[model samples]
Target: MKFMMTFHWVPDTEQRAEAIERFLRTGGVPPQGVQLLGRWTSADLGSGFDLLETDDAAKLTEFAYQWSDLMELEIMPVLEDAELAAVFGRVAKK
Candidate 1:
């Protein structure tokens, strides 16, 4: 499945900076089973989003846990447009 993960930096500027440095130093690796498809950050740098694909939900949780101390995260399941259209087609035919 594909997932969208949003990361919102903590309100403290210093802490957020430190966490970002640490993540960069560590190469910001995602948890096992989770593959990063893309990433984007807000212009102001307060928040970011990652597009990831994974079959194991636990891997997503573990990835979130790794950053839980530095930022708030929102994980959402997502489907591509063609996938949504396929679902709609099935329902329409039924």
Candidate 2:
């Protein structure tokens, strides 16, 4: 499954800096079983979004735990456009 992880950094500058430094030090590696497909950050640096693929949701939590201290995270399951259309079609038929 694919998931969209939204990260909203705390308003504190020091905490945000610490989070960035930690990530840099660790090479910004994603948790096991989680493949980071892409990422985009807000121009203001207040928040960012990551597209990740993983079969095990547990692995997603591992990634979240690493940065939870400095940022608020929201993980949402997502599907491609065709997949969503197919789902809607199935539901409509029922």
Every candidate's CA RMSD: 1.5, 1.4
Q: Which candidate should be chosen as best, given TM-score against the real structure?
A: 2
| lDDT computed for candidate 1 | 0.90
Model 2 ranges with Cα > 4 A deviation: none
Write down the lDDT of every candidate, Cα atoms only.
Answer: 0.90, 0.90
Could you give me the TM-score of model 1 versus the true structure? 0.91
Provide the lowest-lDDT 10-residue window in model 2: 23-32
RMSD of 1: 1.5
Off by over 4 Å in 1: none
